[model samples]
Target chain A: MKYLTYILRNARRNPARTGLTIASIAISMFLMMILTSFFAAMQEANSASRQYNRIIVMNANGFAGVVPIARVRQIAAMDGVVAATPFAWYGGKYQNQRVLFAQFGVDADSVFDTLEEFHLPDDQLAAFKADKAGAVVGPKLAREYGLKIGDAMPLQGDVYPVDLKLNIHGIYESPRNSDQRMVLFHHDYLDDQLRLLGPSSSSGSSATQPSGRAGNAGIVFVRCKDAAATAALCKKVDDEYRSTDNPTRTQTEEAFGQMFSEMMGGMKDMVFWIGCAVVVSLLFVAGNAMAMAMRERTMEIAVLKAIGFGKGLVLTLVLVEAVLVAGLGGALGTLGSKALFDLFDVSPYTGGFLPFFYVPWRVALAGLGVSLFVGFVSGVVPAVMAAGSSVVDGLRKVV
Target chain B: MSAPPSIELRGVEKEYRRDEFVVPVLQGLDLSVADGEYLALMGPSGSGKTTLLNLVAGLDVATRGQVIVHGQDLGRLSEGQITRWRADNVGFIFQTYNLVPVLTAAENVELPLLLTKLSRKRRRENVATALRVVGLEGRERHYPRQLSGGQEQRVAIARAIATDPFLLVADEPTGDLDRGTADEILELLEQLNREFEKTIVMVTHDPLAARRAGRILHLDKGRLVDDVINDSAAAAG
Candidate 1:
């Protein structure tokens, strides 16, 4: 601490070079902080999705293909099944803008039963079940689009080719992050709307709509007695429908969430590789700067040794200088990133892509640790060479 | 009965081995200086004046024989002990006046005192006193580049004496100064030795600078070839 001024003034010997080195470290550490935050958010969302022990029934092809709606009651009545709901994707655009939130047609009476994590007002639930056009949105969706009860929502359909006119009757809260970005309306309302788009009716659009797919269900969400019953229930349901016209495939909800995680696995791999590259590049940048500093101060180091500083003390000074540079950069990157997120509202830009996105304090701390490690490793070699240099050879410069 | 000589070199032989060749710099030699003596070593390049100074200052060790200063045999001290010994006992003045360019004049003088366990206030007082002794008290905040060569040398001298060491070894202390500034530096050295009783061993190529010392020894080919007693130096200062 006594020599801190000397070490710091030595760093300021080349202000531009030191500034650039710090900036580079800050930028890379900033990237690491963001990436770490994103992974945490992703994992948290996935963990939240697994709070209920449930299974999903979809057409054998995938969720893109629909299961028959008739399977709902049969699955609900199956042994070890608690409740079941038809969850059909209604990929519609709101106000002609492609707002990227999930729009699903679900059986209101049974969806809250199957996905037990969600809560809504009893009166709002009654209203949702009474009116075919009544809809309920998650809390985040309501906040994101500034939705309130009694507001009208007009969605132009692109998948089913049937537009929906829905009135906001309720806003639901959920423990799960992804669930907070969903809009669930009655599946029967969608079927009825599709019925009006028949060949005999000229109702919503002039474009020809696909026929005879009105009773399709994107998925039949089934809650089991517990996690242990999910696999057996899924197999029983799949086996029960194997001989039908629309053969079904089923899985535990956790497994279904893992499928989406697998999709993100590719992107996560890319991010991880990019993070590794940034660290390596930062090390080289910091190491080169330390080496250059050592070269410039060769005589200065010799003078320090001659004036009574031991070789260990000289080595420590150089290493500490390097660490200080990298540590400052790390602090700027990590703390600055956290502060930036705190200062801004980033959800509107995300379009509900990442729910509950946040940079944890632990991630910031880890980032700082990485920066310090980078400093230590980079400075060690240069410090050794500088400390080991002979005072006679160093004073040779004067001659 | 008087105090033994402050510095003693008995049969000191020094050599450097580079690429498997032993290049002898100092042959077996004997010399001594009294507690308050001011001595000058004059020689051409490669004449072992600087080598002898380094040995006497504990900056280097002899390949053979003993180099003693202030009653401690330097060759017997361990590496760390010798460094501590130098810090407590020997002060050095280089030809370049090697002040750290980034530090102010006062900071440069305070450099050596940092090795001691002195409190910050105590170190500051010592620095002020050393700077005052070298007549650089008011210029403590000035940097090396901002000061003249004569002033920079004064700062270096202040740094050397900051710990109040027993011995001072200056290798061409005024080599970079002009004739006028050189005389000023020589007089300052004379003051340190005269009024303060500092034992100074200076190496120089300039004959005029050599005459400023009480005794002068000229070296040729690693041996003392001429020894002269400059009786005029002590009277002038």
Candidate 2:
């Protein structure tokens, strides 16, 4: 107990240095905690975005191109294909405001019935089917645009020459990762609208022809009956479309997310390395603070030793001061991270990816553990210096 | 058949090395102090007066021979054992009054008692008694810096006696004080010796201070030159 008092007195003697050490420790620990939580959240979002059984059948080229609508039907009739829905990527500007979202034309009724994940309220579902130019926007998009039920919107096409006047029948909220921040409406309306906006007399292709260029949809989403049947079903579908007029490239959602993660190469490594650097720098700063404090108290330590304080007791007192500074700093950083979450709304990359932001309890615990370990590492040298000092020499030192 | 001398040194020597040569301080010195003896050691600078005090207090070791204080040979004891023995038997008063800066007068007095098995209440009682003996009962709560130089020395003396050690070793206890304060301090030491029968070995260069002791031993070049018993007139004046 007396030793604890001495430690407190020592720390209080240099409040500024102690406070700065604590702040540095706390801030770095908090950042590490936040980074780890983001990593965890990203892992969760990546897995959630791609369901194992759902296979995406896009053009043989990549995600940007489109496949014929005829191929979508053919893929749906395959052996393990429980259901298939065609998705057409329609590029358009909302009210010329440069607002962007995934404007997709899907067979609303069949797609909703086939994919168990696209869930909406019964009223919204009914309203979506009742109106011809009706659309159900993802909840995040609707919130961003202030679009409510029964509101009408004019969307100017970016790819095809057409203007889409659509009714916001209902807003859709989805737990599935793919359903976030998208706009889905009936495919028939887009197909009809595309014919009106295309050239009246093109050289070789007619707009009315079903197998022509106007009839092409972006991709076919094949929802498997059982998640385990994905590999076999995918193989069968690829083989059915092999050497056909238009070949298909099929992949699971996880593979798709992995491709995106791989695209952001060296970014992950940089963040990890920076985190390590921060920790190392913080360790040195904390160590220096403890050493300075120890140096200042040389006389007091000698006095204690001469008066009968054991070397072990003196060492413990110095270490306690260091640990207290570091531990409190770690706690402060963690609390600061939590307060940050309330003050700022962190959105995923601008119109590109969904960002995962959260602070896990494990990260907090690990941060505190690191702080304690660094405190110990920083304190040992000074503690040994104090313990090994000669009491006679120490007493002779004029304070 | 009488009890062994309270302290005995036989052929004790201390040396300090300079670059390549050894400078011997005390060479083959022998001395004995009996129980209840108030002995004053007077010497010029570099005559090894302080070194002798350190040897007696177990703060330093003799390069050769034995230093038997309270009938225990210091040379044979381990460092830890020597420390414990010093805490148990010796009280040191330095010229600068080395009381801990952080502690109050009472806390400084209670320091040596911390090494003992005494209860908190017993430690407090001992500290209070020691302070009262030095006539600083009301100054117990004051910090060392708040007191005058003379008062700080008095507090240090109170601390030395707090543990009730058998030997009080003072190295120029009145060296840094004014003449008036020095006289008062010498009077206090004489009172402690006569009233409590505490054996004191004081090392000082001041002849007037030496005259107050029951006996004075003068040293020159590490050799004893004079051993005189002071009469009543000399002791009082």
Candidate 1 chain A worst ten-residue window by lDDT: A202-211
- Tens digits of per-residue lDDT for model 1 on A1-399? 889989999988999999999999999898888888887666666666565888888888785466778889988999999999998878899977785778889998898898888889899999998888989998877887899998998889887778899998999988634557778898998988887767665434332234456777888889999877888988898999999877888988767877777888988898889988888899999999999999988878877888788888888999999999999999999988888876754655686566556666778888898899999989999999998888878877673
In candidate 1, position B50 carries an lDDT of 85
* B1-237: candidate 1 lDDT, tens digit per residue: 887878888998999998999999999788888898899999889999988888888888999989878788999998789888888988889899989999999999999998999999999999999999999879999989999999999999999999998688898998899999999999999989898888899999999999989999989889988888889997776
Please report, as a value between 0 and 1, the fraction of native contacts recovered by candidate 2. Answer: 0.11
Clashes of each: 0, 1
Residues forming the 10-long window of minimal summed lDDT in candidate 2 chain A: A204-213
Per-model chain B TM-scores are 0.97, 0.95
User: Which numbered prediction scores highest in DockQ against the true structure?
Assistant: 1
Runs with alpha carbons beyond 4 Å of true place in candidate 1: A48-61, A67-86, A109-131, A137-149, A170-181, A198-213, A220-255, A345-357
Model 2 alpha-carbon drift over 4 Å, by segment: A30-40, A44-62, A65-259, A348-354, B4-10, B16-26, B29-60, B68-237
The worst-scoring run of ten residues by lDDT in candidate 1 chain B lies at B228-237
DockQ for all candidate structures vs. native: 0.57, 0.22
Clashing residue pairs found in predicted model 1: none
